[model samples]
Every structure is written in C-alpha cells, then in structure tokens.
Target: MAAVTLICRPAGVLPKLSGTCSPVLLAAGPVTVQHRKIHHAVVPKGKGGRSSSSGVAATVFGGTGFLGRYVVNRLGRMGSQVVIPHRCDQYDLMYLRPMGDLGQIIFTEWDARDKESIKRAISHSNVVINLVGREWETSVAKAIVNAIKDPDANGKTYALVGPNRYLLHDLVEYIYALSHRPYLAYPLPRPLYHLIARFFEMNPFEPWTTRDKVDRFHTTDMKYPDLPGLEDLGIIPSSIEQKAIETLRRHRRYRYLDAEIGETKPAKTVSY
Candidate 1:
C-alpha cells in the first residue's frame, strides 16, 4: 500500500497571547488552519454520449452509500434501469428518491448479507453490482459468494465494484469461476483518507488520519480471464483485454488490465 502525505498551515499568523499573570505568550488554544500541500491523482473526463440512455437493467446491492450514490447517478445518467437494495426504508431513501425519479433509479428492500434478499434483487436485472461490505465483521468476499451462488430467471451478468482491497480479490476470483462475468474494482487515485480529508477540509495530520496507507490499481488490471487459484490464478489472457477496456471506458474512471493474483502491480509486461 502507498501512503499520501498532507501538510497543514495556520490560516494566518498566530496572534500574541496576552495574560495577566506573567510575560505575554502565544496562545496554545486551537487555531484555524488550511491545507498547504496539494496533491491529487488525475482522472479522465467521461466522454460525451447520449447521456440519458442505457438499455440494460442494473441492480446495485449497496446503493445508498456515498460511492453507491455516485455509481447510481452515473448509471442513471446513462439511462440504465438502476435497482438499489437497501436494508431499511429510512432517511437514506430521502437522498436516493430524487435519483429514482430520473426515470432509472429504483429502491428496494434487500440485505446483502442475506442470500434470499440478494436473490430477490437479482431477479429483476440482467446486470448486478455487488457493493456490500462490512465495516468490521464479515469479509466482503463472503458477501459476493452468497450473491452470485444463485441467479434469477434470466441468467445475469455481474460486476463486483468496491474498494481495491485485498479481500475483494478473493471475491473477484470466486465470481470469475462461478459466473465468468467481469469484475470491476474502483481504485482511488490516492489514499482513501486523503480524499476524505480533501472533501471535508480536515487536518490530515490528526491522529485519525495516520491510520492506513492506500493502494492504487488500474481498471485495466482487473480483467482476469481465468480463475487464478480456483482454476489457475494468473494474469488474464490477451483475448479479454478488449472486454476490460470496454468496461473501463464505460465507467470512464480508469482502464482495466491484467493483474497478478494476490498482488497489485501495473500490467506493463502484458501485451494488450
């Protein structure tokens, strides 16, 4: 994993503190500051198309989250019938409802951790996006396995989308063996915490920010033709490169290439 560094600077010079006790001294209280160092990864701009026009029905497992909302919006703009499975019909739906009226977003009650709920969600779509994960308990790999183990009346295609974490690789391989549908992983251009800090204008030097380093993976690297270990976990064959490219192009984020199973590396040696 790679780490992103950030520096913070006071918004203005600290005012000299005045006290009635002894010699005046600078105040040690909290001070307002702004980030000084600026570093960001480049993301390609999406190509213009018939913005509101997708012909496929797509289901999103974790469709009410931050990333899920973004994905749903993008898919809605693309005109795909977007189905989002939610655990509760609470305040979360308030934020998701507007997207639903775009003539594409649909909200349904389903639990990613429950196979029956997953099956019900899949029944209505030909393409599925599994975005479920645990903050601390269950592994994401298990969630994906449970979702794909069974398909609806119309056999569907699935693209597993989530953070480019290690646990997801196992799920990717498992999905490849089970359904042979392409897997999609979104790799943040920089560390996740840094992006969060930039979004919220937080001090990156805070102890909470020092947690974990983040890794970057290109979309082109996610297309594995064969199940690495389940069958033969290795680099995806050259034949699948085009498919990966098309998938990446559709998302307009990054390109997907071949990846070494259990490792994160740019597929420089693999010929496209």
Candidate 2:
C-alpha cells in the first residue's frame, strides 16, 4: 500500500487533524462533527463557538498599507485571524474582508504613539511579526513563516532578505520594464536625496526615499544582508526580475481592457 499526503493550499501540507474536537468544537454525531476555528484545534460544529478558523491569531501593524494586503491575505488563507490595526477609513479595508472566512479577519483602530492601544492589540496573540521596516514586506514574510513552524527558530532572529542584489539604477530599469512606464531612476547626490526625503516626510503618505534606506543600500552593498536569509528558513527568495511584475502590476500606467495589466504583447522576435 502507498501512503498519500494531501495539502489543500499555499501554506504547505499540514499535519492530520486529531480526533475528538477541542478547539471550539460542536459535537452532534461521530461523522457529523466539524470544527469551529479553522486550523489550531479541532472544534465540532454546535459544541464550539461560531468562528471561521484558528491556529494563530496575528495582529498585524500597518496591516492596511502596501505589503499589508498580501500578508493579511496569506494569514487569512491559513486559517488565522488577522487583527488589522487601521487608522484609515473603513471603506479602504472593505476589499480585504473577503480574503478570509467570517470572523477570521478582525480590525482595530490604532494610534502609533499610544502604548496602551499597542498592548491591547497584541493581548491575545502568541506570535509577534513586525513588518514595519521600510520595504520589508516580501522578505520578512518568509522568515516569519519558518520561525513559526521551526522549533529551532525559538528565541532566534533572522533578517528576511532576497537573494538578488540591485543598485538603485538596476531597480529603476527593472521597474521600467515591469511597469512598462517611461520613468527614469536618476542618481542624485546623497545630500540632495536626503533633503528631498526630509521634505516629503512632512506629508505622511507622500512617497519619498529615506536616508536610512540610502545608507542601508550602501552598507548592504546594494544587496540582501550578509546573514543567513530566506534560504535558511526554507524559502528561496525571489529575484527582482521574477518578483517585479506582480509586485508592480497595480501600478502599471497604461492598460487595455480585457487583458492583464502588467503583460503587454510579447516582445517582437527577430531571427538573424
């Protein structure tokens, strides 16, 4: 006889669920039992509280920002309740509701400077994952996943990083191709870049490049960190060439109806 392994989604294969529901379970009959929360413990229908899923309850700060939607979606799909702290209007978050089952994605309004509110947000969580660092989205997510799953990761910290190295010029050219936009990445003096960043800082939502980022780029030699990275956590970091399109799809400047935004007609083939 051959053994079979079944995995239902993108988070990799999960262990077989145990019998006799405990994680919010409602029991009616042997075959009629179902769980309340999604993944943590088995909860039978009727015996358990009415909830969509469980396993981890994640409180994601900056959960409504860029990279946030992706993280929230991933968490929601994995049978976790993502507590999103938002200061934005409720309508802005409406699109994220469908990412998970009912009651699986919670929202709380938070002020960054409020210590008590920060404590309240994390009061029920067992894990703390910070995506606060600028441009820290894709890389950190992989590390957080491993740390959660690997017991060896307990008390250890990892710098979630991509494998590809890119200069500012390199990234700009990639984005130009990926977004199919005519933007140019011009190199500016370090001091001028800092000045521009400081000016833009006045507008909380305005886009600006920070001095820390510029400094880090230099410190990192315009690449991922020297420490063990995503590979250490069993995730192969994506190349900029690979990750650029999907990452910039929504920002594509031109779009023709009835077709995908990022993909234009294939480049013309010329045989010599």
Candidate 3:
C-alpha cells in the first residue's frame, strides 16, 4: 500500500523553536512568499483559486513521477503550497511551477537513499504523499489530492488502481505493437531471470528486467480487494487504454507516418 504521512498542527501562529535559528525559506528561483507557518485547519483565505491559501503545505516525495505531476497540478490549482523534492535536473521540474500561483511550488534537491536529505525535503510540509512507483495514472493523483483535503481522510488508506488490468506479457506486446515493432519475445524461467539480474547489476547500463522488478511482476496484483478506492474519493478511474496510444505514439517507427486505423490488435483487459 502507498503510505501518506500527515502531521497535524493546530491553527494560528506557530510557536518558535526552543533555540534561535535562522528561518529556512521555501522558495524556488525568484518566486518567494512570506515565511510559511504549519497549520491544519482549512481556514481558506482569499476568494479561492490559485492565489488563495488552502492551508496545506504538502511535500510530494515523488513529484517528478507520472502521478506526482498531476497531483501537484491539482494542489496548485486549489491554492495549496507544494514542496517538491527532486534529484533530477532542476530544469526538468521547472514546467511544474506554472501549475500553481507564484511561489506556491517550492523545489528542493534531495537524495532518496539518504535519510537526512529526505527529512530536509519534507521539513516544512504538513502532508507527505508518497507515490513512489513507475506505473501510475492521472486518476490516482486526483484521488490523492482530494483525500488530502478531506478532514475525514486524515488517517485512512485509499487504494488507487486503474479501472482495468492486463497481463504483463500482453501489455508489453501491445506497447511494442503501438511502436510498430514486431513482438518476438518470451518470458524466461524465473531462475534464469535471477541470474541475468545479477549480471546486469554489475553492468553500467542496466536494463528494465531487474531482479526486484521481475519478482514484482509475479507478486503484485493490479486489482486488490477489501480496501477503499478512487470511487470513494469521488473520482472515476481512467483506463490505461485512454492514454496508451497518446503515450506510445512518440515511439512509433516513423514519426510522420500514422498507423492504419486498426493495425494493432487490442490487448484483452480484465475489468474489475
């Protein structure tokens, strides 16, 4: 399950720390705002929208990932201040600034493997949403931000799964087909995959088939039961089919040449 950390603070002026320490300003580039104080009460000020204050200072741990970007967008539009921790090029994350009002999005560089760096990234946040996964969708982000604002969701867990599921092998083939590539691959035995993973660990350029990932392919299920989901947060989940073509089109063999209307067969989807 994806873990979301919420540290509740009372409304009004925050008490100063025991010893005198210089206040750390959370700003990116030239964008600046008054020093932020921790608050949980949704004392919304201004006439709403981006310029207003939602009283939420969120540190999105995986802000550069697929789902995190959308979550940041929604949070920005709703007037919430977001702290984005990134290790990638600072330029890559600049596009996210316009999503919120000026100074609403703050970027801090942090290494994920280091505990101290992670602590610094989330130091000023009242909420921390961890969407640290490769496979994600827009609906998941919407649901997450919605949950963050809902007082009832303070300690609840919400499962964010897509509307449909497909076998890994079938999904890979469909993606290749979208890219106009011939599919001629077979899954190797589990033991062989483990051996290959060990070899690739030492290789400079690691491929997608890592041992941990291979283990996940067999262990994780897309559709899980007995948990709250996106619908509970008033969100209708989007299907992967809705975005696959748009997402994979760039990888098409020829950039200008479009595929015939029905060239690729649709992968079988399991509706949950």
Candidate 4:
C-alpha cells in the first residue's frame, strides 16, 4: 500500500485573508478589547463661548433697532443668546422688550462711538455687529465711517444727508470698507438683501409668475412699517418678510449681524 500523508490545518486562525472581515474572531469568554476614542472638547479661544453644535459664540450690536430687533429675534429663535448694548434705558428699549422675554437678549449700556465701550462690548462677544446707522438728518456717513475705522470715536457726529448724500455713497463706502476687514461684518452675509429692504419698497406687477410675485413680495416686506393693506394694491403679500426669512433659513445663511472680537485682524491698508 502507498504511504498516506495528512496535512493539518490550524483550528482557530484563518489561513489568508485580504478584504474586510465581518464578525472578527476572538477568544471565547470575557475578552476585553481596549479601544481609545479621542474626544476633543474644543473650547472657543475668546470670551465668546463655544456653540454646543458649531462651538462658536454669536454677538450682535445695535440689537434693539428695527433691523437689529429682527436679527435678535432670529438669533434667539436659533437658541443664541444675543448681547445688545444700548445707551438708553428700558423705557427707551420698548421695542426690544419683547425680545428680552425670549431669554436670548442680553442688554448692556455701551456707546458704539466710544472705543472703551466698544472694547468692552467686544470683550465678551465673539462676533461684533454694527447696525448703528444714521436715520436722522445729520452727519450719519462720517459717524458710521469713523466708527468703522476707529472702532472708538463716540458721540453721533455724522450728518445724515447733505452734499455728501451719505446714505447712498457713504453707506456703500462703509459697507465696502467693512468687507475688507478680516472678520465677517454684520450685514456682509446678505448685504444685497438688507440693502434692498433698507432702501426701497416692494412693488409687484400682475401677469407675473407665482415665483416672481413671491420674490417681489419677499423683497418688499423686509423694509419696516409693514404694509399688509398694500397687497390689495399689488405691491406685496402680507407674509413677505416671513417668507424672505424662511427663504434665508432654507439656505442656512443668516442676514443678522454678529461679531467675533480679536479674531478681526487690523486692516493692512484701507482705501476710500
């Protein structure tokens, strides 16, 4: 009879494997595999606290004004505690009082024109939003420009309208200047939207498509002094502002202003 040879295979270990394996083998009872999962608690660098989700803090300036009020409302709705510094008292803040109840409004007294006040405001806030524009008939342009440039220089000194036409030219210039800053400015995220709302009223024409009508109505309602009755005149629908805000939300882009202090590097060069 020919001699018979037997090849023995290992019982536990597999011979050769290349691709991924499911149900990895292990010794039977009470096997403890050590796994290290590094969980890094990223703390925001500055005084502005980290967001639980994005880990960033949001700060809003002029949080009591018309646009600011809307911004603060949106921020609060997003569960962000917005810091609003104003020189006026509670009675003066009547418009903003509703926001206070939202539990996201923090009110403090600080003059935007004063550097000390601004510095203080910026200290606790991660983002700095400048919504203090001149609505009165004075040197609003110069005031806003100085505030943007100096970050200090208190007292409302800019003239609203004059040979300067500050609202048109200076406003655009200041916005441009702010765009150059390292940190994102308040209105920069959605500047065109704010500009159109702040500057003009909406008017829609008939025979327009529903999308066009919605767009016209949305743009028009962003301005203050709501005109629901105007819908009858074919200007804008009553829900224009709400619709625009919803549109902005759907895009994950916010038009409100917030600040990140110290994160802003000084401008190397500024041009008029």
Higher-lDDT candidate of 1 and 3? 3
> What tens digits encode model 4's per-residue C-alpha lDDT throughout 1-272?
00001111111122332222111111112212212221121121223322221111234565666556665554444334456788666887766645433444667788656878755554433234455531222122122222222212221122122221122323433433333332333443344655455444344533323433334323311222222122221223222222223333333324322332223332232122
lDDT of 2 by residue, 50-128 (tens): 2444455666776776666777777666666677877889999999998777877788888879978876765554443
Best by TM-score: 3
lDDT of each: 0.39, 0.52, 0.66, 0.34
* Model 4, runs deviating above 4 Å: 1-56, 94-103, 134-272
Taking every candidate in turn, the Cα RMSD to the unseen true structure, in Å, is: 23.9, 11.9, 7.7, 28.5
* Tens-place lDDT digits, model 3, residues 99-148: 89988898988887897887777666656666666456666677777676
Clashing pairs in 3: none
Q: List TM-scores for all candidates, in order.
A: 0.33, 0.61, 0.71, 0.31
In TM-score terms, candidate 2 sits at 0.61
- Scanning candidate 2 in windows of ten residues, the lowest lDDT window is 1-10
Top-down TM-score ranking: 3, 2, 1, 4
Better of 2 and 3 by TM-score: 3
